[model samples]
Target: MILAELTIFPTSEGVSVSRYVKEAVKALEETGLKCESGAMSTTIEAPDLKSIFDAVERAHEAIVKMGAKRIHIDLHVDHRLD
Candidate 1:
């Protein structure tokens, strides 16, 4: 399993990005992965690396559809065989 944390945002969207962030969160949640929302980032647990990347892509696309040009993502992943 992989435990990951993702912090994504549109850099050109000004200081407050709650609206876009919420959309991304919704998209990710719809994936049915184990997830938790936090102030700075979101944490998710997935069966494999593919699952984690897929979810992040969905989140990114969600924001892009919201009129984002340049996007930034901070990701952390921990893979454990156990």
Candidate 2:
């Protein structure tokens, strides 16, 4: 199992980015992975690295589609074989 913490936002979007964050969450939810949203980041549980990456990509695309010129993504992953 893999647990990934993701923080995605637009650097060009100025101080307020709640709308973009909400779009990202919606995109992540569409991926069908388990997601827990927090104030700083969103935690996702997936079966493997590929799944996590794919979901993150979708989230990025969602934000891009919303007209963001520059996006920043912070991701931390925990992979456990046990």
Candidate 3:
């Protein structure tokens, strides 16, 4: 599996982005990826890069739909054969 860590948020939305975060979470769910959300970020596991990319794309779209002109996304990936 490909393990991915994603931190997606708006840089200029406001002090709190709980609403947008929720939206992103929803988008992630819709992508059918295994995801766990933490206080500062979320971790997702996918079978391939396509699934991870789809999740990330959906997440970015969610933030943009929230009216954020500037968004910050931190993505880290770890791929293992075992």
Which residue segments of model 2 deviate by more than 4 Å? none
The per-model lDDT (C-alpha) reads 0.97, 0.98, 0.93
lDDT order of candidates, best first? 2, 1, 3
Q: What C-alpha lDDT, on a 0 to 100 scale, does residue 3 get in candidate 3?
A: 98
Instruction: Go through the candidates in order and give the C-alpha RMSD of each one to the true structure.
Output: 0.6, 0.5, 0.8
* Span of ten consecutive residues with least summed lDDT in model 3: 25-34
Query: Which has the higher lDDT value, candidate number 1 or candidate number 2?
Result: 2
How big is the positional error of residue 32 in model 3, measured in Å on the Cα after superposition? 1.2
lDDT of 1 by residue, 3-66 (tens): 9999999999999999999999999999999999999999999999999999999999999999
Candidate 3 global TM-score: 0.95
lDDT of 2 by residue, 1-82 (tens): 9999999999998999999999999999999999999999999999999999999999999999999999999999999998
Score candidate 1 by lDDT. Answer: 0.97
TM-score against native, each model: 0.97, 0.98, 0.95
Q: How close is candidate 2 to the true structure, as a TM-score?
A: 0.98
Error of 2 at 39 (Å): 0.3
Clashes of 3: 0
